[model samples]
Target: MSRNGQAFERYQKINDLFNRRKGEMAVVTTEEILQKFEISERQWRTDKQKLEELGAKFEYDGRLRGWRYIEPFNFSDNIPLTLEDMYNLRLAVATLAQLNHIADFKDLPQTVNKIRKAVGRWVDHEAQHKAIYFDPLPQYEGSRHLPFFLDAIEKEQQVQFDYFSFQAHQPQNYRFDPYFLRQHHQRWYVGGWSHDPNEGFIRTFPLERIEGEPIRTGKYIDFACKPKGFNPITYWQHVIGINRPARGLVEAVVLRFNRVQGKYFESQPFFQPYTILERTEDKLVVQMDLMIEIELIRKIASYGHEVLVLAPATLVEVMRSFFAKAAEQYTPR
Candidate 1:
């Protein structure tokens, strides 16, 4: 094989070894790589150098005697797409196609076309003949304001918008210091510091509830004047979904799932800090460290009898009460 072909083959082998133990701290050791590929120490060092040149970062642990990725890195970014890669890109482009109708993503169709043109040759026409389907995008209001809010957040400016919340009797004008724009469950929300005396703290507002265009104030956000210990990036990390509780602490919420649900949860976890405590033939017990919030409770309720809360007496009672009220709705009058 040519030098470039040999290097690509080595890159593929290295990626496979790292991925086999995904999420583990220690990946393959230098000795293991040399033995597996039947290469010398010099060749291994040269391979590492080539990978680093392509933006892959690695750190060596003396105690573990293995290398760990400093950051999540993938060889796919630097390598040419394989047949499988082209198929995956097609699926991704199909998903992005759904966003083309949205005003905020108006340029997506053009971008998608560009991608399709670039990979058109590699795509499998026979596979394209097979009917692959995707659910139509749901019509969501206030998406047009996404760019407006995004610009304000980038500029660190204050904004004012008339909001009509479900709990309110009338629309209220709110002055906010735009900090972050987040999307949850297909709805856009702007999270920032509110100027209202009743809500003089960091909060999130649904863009769908905004009545009109948001007016951006010329004044810039004074980060020094922000509430103590506020970080836009880490604000919602400890919680599932949105709406961080005003006075909530992170708790280890334990749950037991039925065999069927356990398989699903194991494959696709609901949130981060997901760890399996115990596993049996019939049930799987898992733990997630999160702040108890309405969204968390709602998520648990969505699973119905498939899941059971095992720890934190407070969450157990909340789930019980939530089910009771839900059951009451179905009772005969």
Candidate 2:
């Protein structure tokens, strides 16, 4: 058989295993697998892996002499939805409704609608609407281009688009292999590999400022163009928001917040690798190990007198300069 033929046979075997598993009540016995599938244990293991890749949960039971789904599988009857499940569904519907743009996600909106119709009688619409609400963010002008970028990422293709650079005071053309899309503070951002300025570096662009349309360039040969050890998740792990951190090693930042502010931090700690060094009646001292980016500086400064920079003198100076500039802007010349 040809390569395509072999692939098709494998797919058929995996599908057959899925159907058999779906029918079984308590577990799928080894005898059933051997008689129906007529495959060796190793081949069965391979088929199991393929099923798992397709999101089918299964586990082997020695005493039962069979495999069972991690969660009970019931295809015929409707699974009972608890009040908590209804609440989550409500939030899902609300969030999907907010994304007015992007026509590709039509099925998601429809699914949310179906969920609402199914659970309408049980769930309290008005109370849940008030209690769990996702605040709307600024609508992106070029949000229609989201599909094009997503396609490029899926297919490992390069894309071209016109972007408005605030610093340059003009629109510039960009061509790069689309990597990942991230949402921060209700804003969308795309991170990718670009070779415009130098050899190449991973960079991020705000989706809102992405002007014109995204043109699919071509397929990206990952090995040749991309850096050997580049992983977007690891690259942006230590930083906050979309902006790159201050050019240096990640530092340990200690801050003291007043009682009111400390209470807020205690409730919702922002950065990861966070630790509360000391807590007292007067203030709360917390430490976070992360890159000292401009966004981080602004966040700390936003607290004004409530937050004080205890360590990392450089960040403290940045904070001081930030406040001084603000004061100067207000002072008469």
Candidate 3:
């Protein structure tokens, strides 16, 4: 075989070894690879270099006496899925179907069956019967827009769609470069740079409120010069859910939850880096730094009386106004 062919064969075997032994044990030691592949130490070094180039994050640990994968990494483009990988994909599709209520990827079922057949494993009927499940919430209308928006993002093109505005009571035509698609509280959102000359800032559009299909404008965006500090995910990370604050400010929000509700948050926190200030039999006080948005108020209101906003006097007043209005609605006139 030519040198390139030999290198490709070596890389494939190395990838298979890594995939098979991943998480169960580490066969990443120099000595181990040398023994398993019957390669010289110099060749093993070359293989390690190639793996790193292909996006495998392998870090050497003196304590473990072997290299460990910092995260799950896969390099093969068209390789058959491992049994575990196929099973996880199946669970993911089922979960998406349950949650979104829209079959976004039309060929997902067929693709999954193909993966299962490729594995050629016996059907563990008992195991399959008692598998993963999801208590999915109601369907989001915008879920159907996922595929189109994704295609637009991939193609780096402009899209025009009819956006319905609840406040305006009419649908308006909007043209924008679809940059990112995100899910917030089970609702899908597409955000990107608006083509309107007057408004150059980023804007997010709710999928549910989209009036019709998104049409491609046949215009391309040169992402090679895409802004230096632009990251769609990072842009909304600090904001509460999907609402981007008009006057964006990240402030410390202290909340006190009742014991019952607090226990739920202990396992699944509202946001990461939440510091537990006080934990008692009756109440649990925690704090998180987040951007103030209307969605933040909605989230607190969802818990009703179980959660109380303890700090940032501005938020307290907002919550107070919210409750007073709520109280009036419940009160007899």
lDDT of 1 by residue, 114-161 (tens): 888878874467345844577777887879889898888888888899
**Which is better, 1 or 3, measured by TM-score?**
1
Q: Which ten residues in a row have the lowest lDDT in candidate 2?
A: 71-80
Off by over 4 Å in 2: 1-27, 30-77, 101-108, 123-131, 221-224, 246-248
Q: In terms of TM-score, which candidate is strongest?
A: 2
The lDDT, on a scale of 0 to 1, for candidate 3 is: 0.78
Candidate 3 residue runs with Cα over 4 Å from true position = 1-90, 96-104, 118-122, 126-128, 136-141, 196-199, 220-228
RMSD of 1: 10.5
Comparing 2 with 3 on TM-score, the higher-scoring candidate is: 2
**Ordered list by TM-score, greatest first:** 2, 1, 3
| TM-score for candidate 2 | 0.74
lDDT of 2 at 83: 72
Query: Which residue pairs does candidate 2 place in steric collision?
Result: none
Number of clashing pairs per prediction, in order:
0, 0, 1
lDDT of 2 by residue, 55-144 (tens): 567877787688877754333233345577677776777777777445555567777667778888545654455665566656555456
Off by over 4 Å in 1: 1-80, 122-132, 227-229
